[model samples]
Target: MELSNSTLSSVAGLQVVVCVVFTLIFLVGMLGNSLVIWIILCNIKQQFSTVMLILNLAVADFTVLITLPFWIYSFADGWVFGAPFCNVLLYVVHCSMYASVFFITAMSIERFVAVLYPFAIQKWWRRGTIGKLTIGIWVSAFLFAVPVIDQKATHVEHPQCSLLLSSYRQQKGLIVLETLVGFVIPFLVLSICYALVAKRILKMTLQSKSKSMKVIRSVVIAFAVCWLLYHIINLLTVSSILTKTSSPEVSKMLLNISERVENLAGALAVTNSCINPILYAFAARRFQNGFNTSGIAKLFQQLNISIAEKFSNESNIRRDNFQTSV
Candidate 1:
């Protein structure tokens, strides 16, 4: 049932390479996320619900990005931080991850409402509403991350940090809860919202629809690519552990594979943290156009103007034209 000598060697080799790759990811992610936060903060005019959500997303991403060095060190040198610090760091990372998902989901919902129910969206655009939603998202994310606090640093065959479960039953239960709440539910809600948005877009005349909608799609796609495999690997790895009592040999083999896959998946997950800034830069016309004269600063200032006011103004102009025709 033991992992073969060759398998152990390969796992070690993969770990070394993954550590180097993750080190690069950490560097890039930190720079990208910091720039995002800086850009948003400078834009005093970027005060709408969308901007608020994005600002919070950048903050969440930055929180997680700072944790990458710890992971990089762990992957390269093993977990030397002991149990308490490991649990604390794990909690922070998970909380940030959950917050990132919630904020992205909020953005998706906002875009959906803005496109399909523009009139009603005005009522929801109040600072009070957005502020409450922001607080709720962070609070919920923190609550969901409580399970990660149970993870412990272990020195079995090698020093590493992992879930502190005493049996496969506990690990299985925890991973299932995490997979459902952390991945499945949010993704489903986002998919439905985006699907409705896309349907409405299709009904509009090609010339009337703006390319800004593409930004939503790109962000959702980035999230999926980054986190889906990692969740799937965790699920399978946990299931393999459940069977380890009957087949320790097979379980050990699968565990080794999972470790390798997790490394790759973990890197991709953090890589997602840096991608939103690039997508926003390319997809949002206003953001792109304002880049020269401290674009973000101008954008933050623009946020002070409610999106509802813009829509109302446009409606008034149209009404005036109709009145003239009469």
Candidate 2:
């Protein structure tokens, strides 16, 4: 599978294209997600389960955007960051991916609970509890990605970071683990949760229809579609590993196709971050108002007035007390 100079140049050109696409997606995603965070923290008052879930989702997306420069550099000049930095970068990237999936699944569950068992939420779903669960999600994602840290390495000769195990047996095992734990399990959970949520929304009272169930459905479906494509590509990669024969040329072609598909899927995954803020703006009335002029401006004005009043009252009280003492 040795590459000639021309072939190497061609691959470098392809990588440059990928780098530009990913960088653009990452920048737009960062802006949109940061706006979502600001709107949630500064303007939104209700702080429901859905809000918390959205916050966590934004956090995961932000984490990935923060690490994008490292990946962009890797694509541009190969993995010159050495083995340790490569390991850390891969670990962070995978951790963000896992965390993103888990948070989306959590959002589905929260929607299901809010729609189906609204009364039960008061008993179990508090802000503190959701915060704790978010922490657990981060910890779980980090642990899940620990194996990748050990399994990934930078190839000094080719200057590419990739999975360490090139052996068929090891690759098969890793692919199985990745598919089951990383994709299949999370997808199943999210699908079931969304199913229940849809059923609940359908059966809800008239007031519930006026809510943002339609928007929620759209967001969930978009995420599911993106992840489904990613998982399908992963399945193909696994198939490539399993069907590997002694034909070097055929094997190289299959590997190249798998790698290209994987790059496309990764790009699609980054698109998810950008989609979320748009979903929020369009789907939820609160988010729309808070993100726009009326709600956010009014909130800042009210805050400033309250602070001024508090200070004025304090000064008045101090003067009165001083006069009385004199």
Candidate 3:
């Protein structure tokens, strides 16, 4: 579809605004998620299946945030980076996206299992098993993104780098693959797990209704909202690609709108990183207390105390020497 100069300018302006919003969201998400990881690893002593899932989710978010500057630079100046860097960046971004979705799905399943079969959890869901599963998820995500790495680069006409699937055939293939692998499969898994979790929670006795259930519900709702937004944007993008003979002006306008929607959804997805920490703070009493009396603060306190004690010890030694000599 052909776009007029004015329409192109408008699209560029919209892209810039979206990029700025994404940058801010990425920065806030990185800081909040990093702190969550620190609190979990350094301060929290007790680890459960939920904590394991959260740790992996934080790692996935961190990986995406680490690559945000590369994308921000590309968006600002067009993709000045060569084909190789573009390929790597696209690969990493997709890897993180898939990893985040997989981790959330896994968390939902874990919650379902814990709720449905609480007695068997200690026997079946040990830390070692979780570690192995986490490694497998990372590996699978990296492999799934391989095609994206191969297909993405800076286009000859458009200065920006993007997936090289502009043709009808290529775009259809990508859309099908992305819909099935990226969204449909994960969404199905999460939905099933959530349904079971909800069923089990509903069956619980009134006395069994607890803070943990509330926390799980919040996380599940947040994850569902994020993915639902992403899925809607993806569907619109697919529709734009499939419809032929559409008016150039209309198509361009639709494309612009889709781009903005996709960007906003992406930002919302990243917000999950920050929201997890808040969920922990509100739902987990132990986490709240641990954050308050964290080892990070304790480390600084210990250093000061040690320095004062050393100085006092040296003074006492000098005083004793002086008294003996006198």
Candidate 4:
């Protein structure tokens, strides 16, 4: 069914709702990610690959959350920010988006390695090497975001920011590239890593695993679901654009429906940034133990899950050394 002008007004109203919702998400994300970063930096004596990965992920999420105010404002009002500023902000958003994906995927790979080749990790994956790799990931993410610089701000009825090129061929190419690189490949890698980890976990008793493992599983599942919906909507929109060749009217209808759905898909995609810290609060034993004095700690403590096995294992090692010296 074709939507009338009233339906277009409803879409605008939904965009306003998106602004309010995104603002709330930003506040919560900033608080949660900051706490995660603080706990990791202040309390941890020795940094491991896991620590570095989590720290980077928190930083990336924080960076993304910070840019959200501009987006919220632009959604509610028009894009008052000039083209250069809009482009820069969009670039930051894209970089952080990909960085989150990379870091999450890295976490899964790190877990898979830890579970599958514990001894090899110490030898093959040095902390310094992992740190360097994290830097490389950030640099690559920034490079991936270079396409945003081409986006220009236009003011006709109202100021709007959009792609400079409106060619159907170029738009299709860019969308296909984004879907393949941004969504498909990283997601596939994440799934495979987690599948291997899950296979290994199944061999062990439930009690033997860490609570953080379950948290990781949940994060992966959430990422998959949210981004899967986001990308499906994107593909549908792209298909609709392609259909202009056969039937312009049908294409216009599909595009209108896609536009109406865009807010929900975008919200789902942005939600990944807000979920990481909550996962840590509930599932990460070290986070609970390290921040014991805080209110958040109380919340974490109430979560009835086993402590991470690494903490207990470290204590065991210390006790063994003490006994050997005696």
| lDDT scores in order | 0.74, 0.69, 0.67, 0.72
On the 0 to 100 scale, the lDDT of residue 246 in model 2 is 53
Residues 79-136, candidate 3: write the lDDT tens digits: 7777777777778878988888888888777666666665445555543777778899
Compute the lDDT for candidate 2. 0.69
**CA RMSD, predictions in order:** 4.3, 11.3, 14.5, 5.6
Q: What is the TM-score of each candidate against the true structure?
A: 0.82, 0.78, 0.74, 0.81
Error of 1 at 223 (Å): 0.4
Kindly list the per-residue Cα lDDT of model 2 for residues 80-180, writing each as its tens digit: 77777777877887898888878887876766665555545544554377778889999999998877676333233344566666566765776677678
In Å, residue 87's CA in model 2 sits off its true spot by 0.5
- Give the per-residue lDDT of model 1 (tens digit) for 1-326: 26698888887798788778877777767776677677666645446777788889989988998887877777777888777777788789889999999999888888787777766667776537888899999999999888667544222223456556666676788788778877898899999998787777786543223444565678889999899998988877886887798888888887888876776787788888888876665554465574343654443344334355446655786899999999
Clashes of each: 14, 0, 0, 0
Q: What C-alpha lDDT, on a 0 to 100 scale, does residue 62 get in candidate 4?
A: 94
TM-score-superior candidate, 1 or 3:
1
Runs off by more than 4 Å, candidate 2: 1-13, 151-159, 205-211, 245-253, 284-326
By TM-score, the best candidate is: 1
- For candidate 4, the 10 contiguous residues with the lowest summed lDDT are 298-307
**What TM-score should be assigned to candidate 1?**
0.82
Residue 100, candidate 3: alpha-carbon lDDT: 84
